[model samples]
Target: MRIRLQPLAASIAVAFAIPAVAQTPLRTLDEVVVEATRERDLPGAAAPTAGELERLRAATSDTASLLREQPGVSLYGAGGVSSLPVIHGLADDRLRIRLDGMDLIASCPNHMNPPLSYVDPSNLKSIKVYAGITPVSVGGDSIGGSIVAETRGPDFAQPGQGLLTKGEVGTYYRSNGDQRGINLSATVASENLSLSYSGALAKADNYKAGGEFKNFTATGRGNELARNEVGSSAYDTRNHTLGFALRGGNHLVELKLGYQDLPYQLYANQRMDMLDNEQKRANLRWLGQFDWGRAEARVYHEAVDHYMNFGMDKQLVYGTAVNGMPMYSRGRTTGVETKAEIDLADSSLLRLGALYQHYTLRDWWPPSGTGGMSPGTFENIADGSRDRAGLFGEWEKRFSPQWTTQLGLRYERVTTDAGDVHGYGNAMGNQLVDAAAFNAREHKKTDNNWDLTALARYAPSQAIDVEFGFAHKTRSPNLYERYTWSTWAMAAVMNNTVGDGNGYVGDPDLKAEKANTLSATFDWHAADRRWELKATPFYTRVTDYIDAVRLTNNAGFNVLRYTNQTARLFGLDLSGRMPLGNTALGQFAARGLVNYTNGKNLDTGDDLYNIMPLNTRLSLTHELGGWNNAVEMVAARAKNKVSDARNEVRTPGYALFNLRTSYTWRNIRVDAGVENLFDKLYYQPTGGTYTGQGTTMGINSIAPGIGVPGMGRTFYAGLNVRF
Candidate 1:
């Protein structure tokens, strides 16, 4: 049946004008009114407001850094713009991340090009996170949480307005790393159609710590770095996006094309650095609003070509026998999703959705010289593929003014396979034996996973509310965890993902990880909502957790293989904001948050790696008209409960101070800030090991136990112009 969009549009307009508080008659507007669009989401999901984003974007280029203010969120340092976000104690592949409705995958073995790296901070229009208790609508083979980030899109003009145009230009610079960037966006729109474009360029050099942390400056490449500088930490990248949208009454059709070119992104933790990475993406979506509910369908495709080698800071030549080790990876991902919302009644709603994704990858290393690498091409993961198909349904009901509940269930069929692999290793390790063993096994494997979530909310009084939820989540292993075959120190270290300075082998017989989580949030606010306090406590127990088993120990570094075990994690988050009386200078406010998490392996009694210690941040903010200013103090407890299996490094407790201020006037805005004001030297507990410099090709070439140091005092400024 063909539906008329005009009637649907009319019905939706009437529904939008209907007030929930009263039966008021509609009035024709004489002037255009602009408002932000809100997407319907589960109760627990949260997003940063526009004002917050404006403040944070000036200080960072890494998109993952924008989530630092969110409780229970942390970041794993990587390339300059490719920091990996961690929810609670789980990081990387454990979390489901989506950009413009596309599920992107990291093509590199070391994960240098994460999904968030594709979008610049200045280009984000909306970003949200659902921690722990994720609804089936956004949940699949992920156990930690879900994140959705969308770039700015077209905004249609009024029905009678003719040809509207808008544009913005922004630039930023930082002193510590000599980092600089610029971004531009433009849009042309009519009542029924819109065309938009956005682009960004960013680059940085190696950054230095507050003081000298290393004793030598040799880079094994005939180059020398400053004693205080952290080598292999530079990057250069560019991004471009084009978007188009058409609207007819209540129906909307949107298309977006994106491209990224990264010349280089040096890494401080991995043995190899990204020399070049290119990505292309296309997304198409259709959405409609009906009197009963809403419907949406989306299709997306992505392609990536990635290359890695020894950046200038690492050993490039081995006894003049072999050239720099070169690695390459290519990947393609295609996905389709369909969803619908049905209004069962005034107080009840139901949602159903289905999605399918197919992904393929090829990782190889070509021979570079007449030495051990001259024999044949090394096939790390050849013709590897992973596919998933999922179906989910959710129901939500409002029993009364004070009580509401939601329940959701999801089912997914995941299958993975890989072609045979070969290594060019010449008597270095068990390459032939391992490859033969892997080839003899059945590469095809399948898993049927299930997810369930139940949540409820209660409001006892005007000043208090409580939300609680329970979830059972399941996750299958990524290809790197089940396919990589070699155990050679050189090849193994290239496969490490956790930044523990250890090489890891894969386990094909691994079982899917299943996590059972319980959490509750307590929110308290004043009668008028002038002040607020919020606290969340969560606990999770996991069966068949993919940890590692040590295979060889050399010095402090070790070689390990993926294994299954039992694990558990618990955490608490506390945040509050209060307003001080207005003053002549500005309106002052105080806000702060405290986060703590603990993780342990129940089977081995070892602490989980990369777990953040207890940390807190306090800020004093001031605002008056076009002026915004703030001073922040951040502190953390010592990370003493280290992971014993990988010999995790311990970092001492530290405190730092930062100052920021911004002002806007008419069409121009400026932001300036100083971080690490005192220039205190400190180590990042999760920054991984300090194998960023010298002869890092060998597994035990450098001394172990040195954690990557944090950056020194830095001044930054940003400018934006709108027309």
Candidate 2:
């Protein structure tokens, strides 16, 4: 149904309202009347030129391809969908992902649940990404950054009358040779409740690499392909989610359940190839407000059953035929958290929270070669748990009506416990090393972190709101980085050595990492209401920064261990939106963004590895007669700075262009767009190379190395409707 408002009545109401004298009008006229929730905005230097939600929802290719237009993001993989996101030079577990209020952990060695694949863009209402200095509410020690995906919410109207249902379905076919996909989402909402669901299925054949690849061992001997061109195995994915919510005056309750299954081929980064990844999760939350305070409580549970194997039939293999050898693992996690906020006085608020989590890991390695039901060693079987609690408070006061200052402080304590586990060494050795005896006995410790923040804002004139902020934050190490013992994936192996294969192992006694952050932001609105701008500058100094370090040993294979080092980084971000006025062509607008970050490893006197290069985005959008059209251009410089003490790879930069248009008629909407218009052959400045080799080693011989080059041109179109 189409609803229309009385234009004459709106015009008359606006004309009778008193206008601000010598000041810019607010973006929305009734802004002051609406309750406001302060949202953490992206630091000026890491914001994307255009968001990925819409384009990604209708993507025909992989998640990485859909997001390539954004600055400082990169992907690398054999096929399209398998590529992962590299933000500010970090990917994998380094980046923290949050769905609503819970954390989703990926248990697959090959990273089956990258942030994009976990939540189909079609199901998202909005996504806010903070490259750094994310709010404390998100929790988790994130050295890289954070991505938050929020689902649609209930739409309530005038006390008792509300009905709404909306859904969208889309499919795309690509010419790149062998890939296709379908995506769908639907939602229904009433005054008291809402339901939403989304699903996506994708498939792709092997990819043709732009360079040659080598099949060999670490000793410089094995299969070799002069020119690298091969396709990946066929892979498929299915995901579904159901959510329910109840809302009353000051209390809200939400329940969410999610299921995901991906039966896929093994990639190069994995030790064993995965046959299936089944994941299940449940989440519950209750939030309530009281006369003097507010409280939020949450609980979450998740499980992962992963299946993998070793298969031999590749032409790159030297005259050999091997059957699949199956291996499997099961991972389970349960957590509960709660927080309370008290309104102490007119300008002060106290916050307190506590969290508890338990994790169990077990894996089985089936005996190989014979193929019969033979039981292999169950090398690792460990149970771990963590308990965390924190206290924080914020104080805000206005010196005058136009000036305000705020201060905040927080303290947290974390304790961990883990069972004993084996150590890392050559599994193929003729004799076993009693290395397990030397491994540090399992134990537990309590780590503490502190945060302090201060902010000052001044509205000298109604047209401008200037602000400045300073904060100091610290983070602890994660379980995986400090305790994982695994083999190298084929992709990482082939790329790390000219033919010398190797992999990484976990360290049990790793120390906690720490960082101190400082930042300032400015918001300005032109007196004429024709322009808006925002800028932020920040600097961070990290001591005992943790990293997966590759040992320089030249034995038969490579070995990696985790360690802590010192580092420093600084950057700037600027963005603006301007109105260009109506023309014979149409009503036009312009928006642009620029971001840059530079980092260095003080311990080794080298630049931080995988840092994104300086990048910028500009776009022109036009609107006329129910139609919206836009053209965007993006470009970035290559990151020449690199770590010399560790294995670090440098990525070259490139420029790209895209176009989008949409038409709306009543309850129907259509969107279409073309990406990488010029089909430029460029690479992400932070894209990772095959993981087997450290960065100091060259990747010229690795298959699909040089970090998968950016994809060629592609196009997509989709439709939405309400019923």
Predictions in order: lDDT: 0.82, 0.53
Stretches off by above 4 angstroms in model 1 are: 1-48
The TM-scores, one per candidate, come to 0.94, 0.79
For candidate 2, what is the TM-score? 0.79
lDDT of 1 by residue, 272-346 (tens): 899999999999999898898889899999999999999989889988778898899999999999988787765
lDDT of 1 at 70: 69
Best candidate, lDDT:
1
Predictions: Cα RMSD each: 5.7, 7.7
Clashes of each: 0, 17
Please give the lDDT score for candidate 1: 0.82
Worst 10 residues of 2 by lDDT: 27-36
